[model samples]
Target: MWKLERCPPHTGHQYLYHGSEEEELHVSRQVGAWLRLQGDASISRKHASLKVSHSAQAVKRSICGSIELKELGAKNGTFVKHSNSQNSAESEAREAPVFTEEHRLSSGTEVVLRHGDVVRFGLYDYCYRLVRCELLVATSMLPRSDTVMRDLLLLGGSYSKEWTQNCTLLVMETIKLSAKVACALACGRSVVRPDYLTQLCTAVKQKQQQLPATRDYLPTITEASIQPDPSLFDPNHDRKSVLSGKLFLLSSPKLLKRVQCIVEFAGGKCEVVAARHHSMIEAGDAVILRTPDDANLPSQSPMAAACKVVKRAGLHVVRESDVVLAVLYCSTERFCNPALSQQVLVSTISQSQMQQQNTGIIYAPETQAISNSPASVLSSRSNKTTRTTSAIIPETPGSTGPSSTLIKSPFTPAATATIARA
Candidate 1:
C-alpha cells in the first residue's frame, strides 16, 4: 500500500489500502476504493493508475506496456512524466497520454510511478513523493492478500522541480555514457576509425607532456583521509581546474555502479576496490565512497565487512548517495579535470609501501614544507628530481571510466538546482 497526502484531488492523507504484489493501486473517481480523486473536477473519473515496485534488481517493466520498448532494453525500468502546458492551472486542458504505443509517452502523457517517485495529478498539479519507505517485518500478522505487496507512502514529494530533476539527472547519466561509448565503438569501425585512434593516441601524448615529470617522491597527505575540500577546490575562490579525477568506491557493486554514473556525468573516472583495502591504496587517493548501509547489499558482498582502510589511507569516506549529490554540487568548480589541473604530479607507489600495506598497515603522507622555488629533491631511487610545489597526483588514474573531483562538503544544495525542465 502507498499512502499519499497533502496533495490535490484528495482532502487529506490517504492510504492505498494495501494490495497484493499481483495487484496495483488504482486511483479513480469512479472507483470508491483504493485512492479516489473525487474532489478534482478536471481529472477523469479514472484519470491515472499507479504501480509500485520494491526490488531494484527485479525487472521493473510491466507487461501492460509495449513489448518493443522492453526489447530495446532499459537498465532500469522505464518511467513516465506528464507534460503540462506552461499554464498548468488551466482546467480546460485536454491533452492526455498517447496510448497508441505502449511504453512510449508523447509530449503530454502521464507517467507510471516507480520506486522513490512522486507524480502530479489534476489541473492544479499537486505533487507527491515516496517519502517514507519501510519494510514490514511483521507481515505474518497481516492478511495474506496484501502482505505480498511492498508498502510505500508518498506525500507531497515536491512543489519544486528538485526531486524530479535529481531523479531525471541520475537516470540520464547511464543514457549519456552508454550512448557515447556506443557511438565511439561504432565509429571506431568506420573510415574515420584511424583518425579517431590517432586522435586518442595524440591526446595521450599531449597529457603526458602536460604532466610534471614523474619522480619517486612521497606526498604530504595533510588532506584528511576522507576530507573532501582542500585549499584548491573552494568554489567561491573561482579558479579553473581539471574536473576529471578518479573515484575509489571500496564498497558493493551496486554502489560502484551508482557512483560511477555520477562520476561519468561529472567527466571523471571511478574504480571499485572490493574492500581488500591493502591491495589498492591509490583507489582511496582522490575520492572514497561506501555503500550507505547493508540494506541493498548482495549475499557475500565484499564491502560487507570493510574496516577503516579508507580513513587510514588519508582519504575521507562518504556515503553512496552523498557521492552523487556532492559530485553534482561540485560542478560549481571552474577547473573540472585532473589532467587539466594547474599541474598533475602522479605519486607512484614504492615497493616498500606496497609491502607494508599487505600487512594491514596504512600510512599517511609525511607533511613537508613545499619550497617556493623549483628545487631538486632526492628520489627514492637516489636520483635528482626537480618539481614545483602545489601538485597532487590523482588517485586511480589507471581505472576504467567514460572520462571526472568534486569538492567535499556536507553538501547543502544551492538555493536552486542546476537542472530545470518543462
Candidate 2:
C-alpha cells in the first residue's frame, strides 16, 4: 500500500479548516487544523500553496507499484516530500518533481511516488495503491507526455531533513514564545505578535509529531495500573482476597508523588509504566502516563492491540462515551478545557474507586477516601482557549490502608500493567 499526507502552508494571520458539516460556523469553530504565521518568509513565514491529492480531476502518481496521488496537481502545486538518496542514477530518477506547467508543477515541490504514503488533503484521505505506470502515462494529457513526465521522473528526491529539523526548532521556539507571551499578558505585559501566525507551520509540524506514529501504537496513559492473575477472582481459588475493582488515580506526572501517597495509603501498588501499545489493551492492563523524553525501555516493548481494537470496534457506539483514558502527562495550571478535564476526573475516580471496591471491600460514602481536589473548580477563568499542563491537583478523598483494599497490577507485576482481579 502507498501512503500520503499533507500540511497546509501557514500564511500570515489566517485560518483554514479541514472542513465542516455543522452548517453555519465561524472559522475557529472547526477543529484540528490551524497555523500561526510569524516573522518573514525567509527567517520563518515561508508559505507554499500546495495540496497533494490522492485522486484529482486529471492525474495519477504512483510508486513501488502503487498509486500515491490519484490527482496531484490541481489548483495549487502538489508537492511530494521525498527522502534523499545517493547513486546518480537512483538519485536523478527519485529526486525530480513529476509535474508539468501543462500540469502546473514546479521546483521546491514534487508529488512523491512512494508506496503506502498517507495522503491528507481537505477530505481526500487515501493510501497509495500500486497501478501500472503505462496506464497512468497513457491516460494523462500532455504535449510531450514522455519527455516532460520522464524528465520530471528523473528529478532526484529526498526528504528535507534540515527543513524538518529547522521547522521543529522553530515550532518549539514558537511554543515557548507563545507561552511566554501568555505569561506576560497574565502579568500585564503587552501581547505583541500575539496574532502573528507566521510561526504556525512549526506548530503544525509539532502537532504532527504529537500524533502517534504509525510504527508504534499506545493509547494515552493517564494513571498507574497493574496486571494480576485473573484466577485471583476465582471463587474456588485459594487466593488471599479479592479487592474492589474500582480505583481513582491522577494522570499528571507532576502529581505522581501525590498519586503515590494516595495509592500507598489505599493499600495499592504505585509504579510507572509505558502507555500500552494499542495491541496490549486486552490482557486487562492498566495504562501509565509518562513524559516523552523519558527513554527507559527495552527494545522489544510489549505490544497490545486491545485499546485500539476496542476503540475501533466502536466501544463508544455501544457505550456512548467520549472520555478516552490515555496515559498522558499534563498539568492543572494549563488544564482549562472543561471536556478534557471532565474525562480526566472520571478516569481518576474510576481508578481509585475500582481499587477501593475491588479489594473485597465496599467503600461507604462516610468513609474518608483519600482527599482529592475538584477539577471543575480549578479552571474557571478561560472559556475560549484550552491549555495543556501537568500540575493536576488531587481534589477527592479515597480509601487508604491495608484494611482499606488492594488490587495487584493489571499485567505483569513488573512489566506493563494488564488488568487483573484484586
Candidate 3:
C-alpha cells in the first residue's frame, strides 16, 4: 500500500490518505471521496490522479509497487521535487538529465513517483510527501472500507484543527502518529488503541526533551594547542594518559558534565567558565568544547560571547566529535599538528553535514596516513617529526656506538636522544 502525508507549513487540517494496488486516487478541491485539499486557491476542482500499480513479485509483508501520477487538464500544473536519495552520482552522470529541478507535468501526462517525492498542486503552499506502507497482510485481504486513517489521526491527537495550526507541533505529532500506525499495521492490527498511542506519545515527548538539540556550526582549527606531554610521547605509558598536561575550558552547558567526566578520567584538568569570566579561559590551553547546540546560540548568548573570547585569544576550540575521535584512536598527536588537525576537523564536519541532510553518502576522510592502531599512529608521528626537524643523522648499519642527535619536541623547546646500534 502507499500513503500520502502532508508536509510542513500546514495551511489546513493535516491530510493523510491511503491507496491500494491498482486503485486510482483523485486529488481536488471537492470533498466527496477525493482527497480534500482546502485553503489553497490554486488547486483546481480536478487536479491530479494517482494510479497505483503493484510489482509482479510483490512481497507479502513489504511495500513493493509504483505510483503513476497523471495530471488533469487544469489551469495550473503539477510540480514535483524528487528526494535527495534519487539524485546520485550515476543519475547526474547520465546523458539524460534527472529531475533535479522542480519538474512540471504537462496536462494529460503521467510520471512515475518514487518514495519521499514531494508533490505540489499548483503554485500555492500545499505539498505532500509520498511514502510506502508495509503491511503484514495483503492489500486485498484487508478491509476495503474502514476508518483506520481517521482513527489513527484522532488517537495520535493530530486530527484537530488546533493541532494543525502549529506547524512544528503538527509535523512532530504526525511523525509520531505515522510510526505508531505503521507499527500496528505491520503487526496485522489495522487500528491503533488510544491508550497505547497516548503512552507512546508521552514517552517520545519525554525522550525528545532529554536529547540534545541539533546545531549547524562546524569546528574549525585556526590555532593548535600543542601542550606536549613527555608521557604521551613515550610509547610505554597507557594511552589514557594522553591528556596529562592539558587543561580544557568548557563553555557548552549541556555537554559540560559529560565532557568534564571524559577529560578528568583521561588524567586532564577541566574548568567551567561562563561568558562573564573570560579571564579564566586564559589559564586553559584549549577553550570552548563545541557542541551541537552551539550553532543555535545568538550573539547575545553567553556561550556565543565565550566563543568570541576564545577566538580572539587564538586558543584551540575543540569539537565534541574531535574529542571522541581523539579518545577512540588514543592519540592527541593529530591535534598538535595544525595541518592534521584541520584535516580531522574537515572530515568530521563533512560527516556531520551528511548525517543532517540524510543523504546516505559515504564520506571517506583524506587522512590515509593516519591509521587506527595506536602503535602505527605513534610511528607516523615520530617519522613526521623527524622529517620536519632541522637535525638529521644517518645510522651506520655496521657501527656499534651510540649516536647523539638533537631534535625539537612540541612540548619542550628541544630534546636530545641517543640511538645505539648493534
Candidate 4:
C-alpha cells in the first residue's frame, strides 16, 4: 500500500490508496469521491491522476509495482522532488522542486513515483510525500497472542519507551522492524522474535569490538626509515608532516578538536567553519563531513546548510575514516582510495626510496693510476676505472680517511712510495 501525506506548512492529512482496490485515483478541487483539496483555487478541477500498476507476481496486501502520476494539463503545473537514498548529503544540499512553470510537464506525461518522493499539486504550497508500506499478510490473519510477531513488537515498544524515558542515544524506528522482517524471511520464518534481535545486537557489538581503532594504530612517518622530498628538510619543517600543504574544513562540531589534533600532527591544517561561511572554501580544500548514522538530518539544520555550501562549491567531501586512512598511508592519494592496505603503502614507499637512492648515486671521476711498474699503470689507465659513491654519505665526526675506503690497483705508486719511505 502507498499513502500520500501532506508536506510541511500544510495540514497533516493523508490520503490512502490500496493498490489491490484502486486502479486509479483523481486529485481535484471540485470533487466527488476524489482527493479534494478544499479552498485551494489554484488546483484544477481535474488536476492530476495516479495510475497504480501492480506486478504480476505481487503478493496480496504487499506493496508492489509502481504508481504513475500524470498531469492533466493544469495551468499551475505539477512538480516532483525525487528521494535519493545514496548520497543523501548531496541530495539534502540541493533539495528543490524538479519542475516549474517554465519546465511544466506536458499533458499525459507520466512519472513513476517512489517511496519518499514529494509531489506538488499546482503552484500552491500544497505538497504530498509518497510513503510505502509493506504488509504481506492481512492484519486479521496475523497471530496476535503468544506469537513471535507480537513478542517482537512488544519488545520494540518497550525499548522505545525506555530510551525515550531515559533520554538515551538509541532510537527505534520502522527500519529496524523492516530489518527484522528481512531476517525472518531469510531464515524461512514468517515472523521475528525478541531473541533474534537480541542475538543480532550482541553479534554486532562483538564485531564492532573486534574492529581496530584507526586513530590508535596509524603509522607515524619517520625520517630515518623513509626519505622525503629534500625541500621538506628545511629548518622550520616538521619531520612528521605527511599531510603538509593540505587544508581540511570540518563540518561536524563534535569532531573539531580530535580531527584538528590528528591533522596538525600530520602537518595538515584544519578548521571548523559555519555553514553560512562556506564561501571561504577554496578549490583544493577538502570538507570533512561525518555522515549521521542514526537518522536523516532536518532540512533546516546547520549541517544541511553546510552540505549545501559544499555542494555548491563543488568541494571534496571526505569522511573521518578517509582522513584516518590517508594519514595512515602518508599519501593524500589514499583519500579517494582508502581501500589500499598499509603493507601496500609501505612497499610503495620502499620502492620509491630505492629509486631515489639509485638515481642520486654520484660516481667518482676516473683517476689516472701512477705505479712503479709501467705495464701495470698502462693497464690501469686503459681500464679507466670509476668508483661509485653516495651523494650524501654518513661519516664519523673525527674520521680522517673515508669510513670504508675502496682499494684498486695494488701496484699503485702512492702505496709503493709510502712503503719505500717507511
lDDT values, one for every candidate: 0.29, 0.23, 0.41, 0.41
Candidate 4 worst ten-residue window by lDDT: 160-169
Report the C-alpha lDDT of model 4 over 1-422, residue by residue, as the tens digit.
34576777235644343233355677888846257777777888888888656542343222254668989887788887776432222233466434223245677788887766778888877788775533232111112223322322211212221111111112111111111121122222222222333443333323222222212221221222224333222122222365677666654554464345445555677776565455554343445444222025577766567666655654434544344434434456644222334445434544544433222111122111221111122212222332221111111122112111112211222212221221
* Backbone clash total, candidate 3: 0
Give the least accurate 10-residue stretch of model 1, judged by summed lDDT: 413-422
User: lDDT order of candidates, best first?
Assistant: 4, 3, 1, 2
Greater-TM-score candidate between 1 and 3: 3
State in Å the error of residue 47, model 3.
Answer: 0.9
Query: Cα lDDT of model 1 overall?
Result: 0.29
Best first by TM-score, ranked: 4, 3, 1, 2
- Clash count list over all predictions: 21, 116, 0, 0
Off by over 4 Å in 4: 19-22, 60-63, 86-103, 137-422
TM-score of candidate 2 against the unseen true structure: 0.17
Model 4: residue 419 alpha-carbon error in angstroms: 99
lDDT of 4 at 302: 61
Total clashing pairs in model 4: 0
lDDT of 3 by residue, 1-422 (tens): 34566667233322222234545667888876356668888888989987656532333213244678889975788898886444222233454333367888889988888756878988876677765433222111111212322222222222221111111111111111111111221222223222333343333333222212111111121111122122222222243465667666555544465455445544566666565467755545444665434556677877677766765665545644334335433666653222233445445434433333212111112111222311111112231221112221111122111111111112211111100000
RMSD of 1: 23.2
Report the lDDT of model 1 for residue 367.
Answer: 12
User: Comparing 1 and 4 by TM-score, which wins?
Assistant: 4
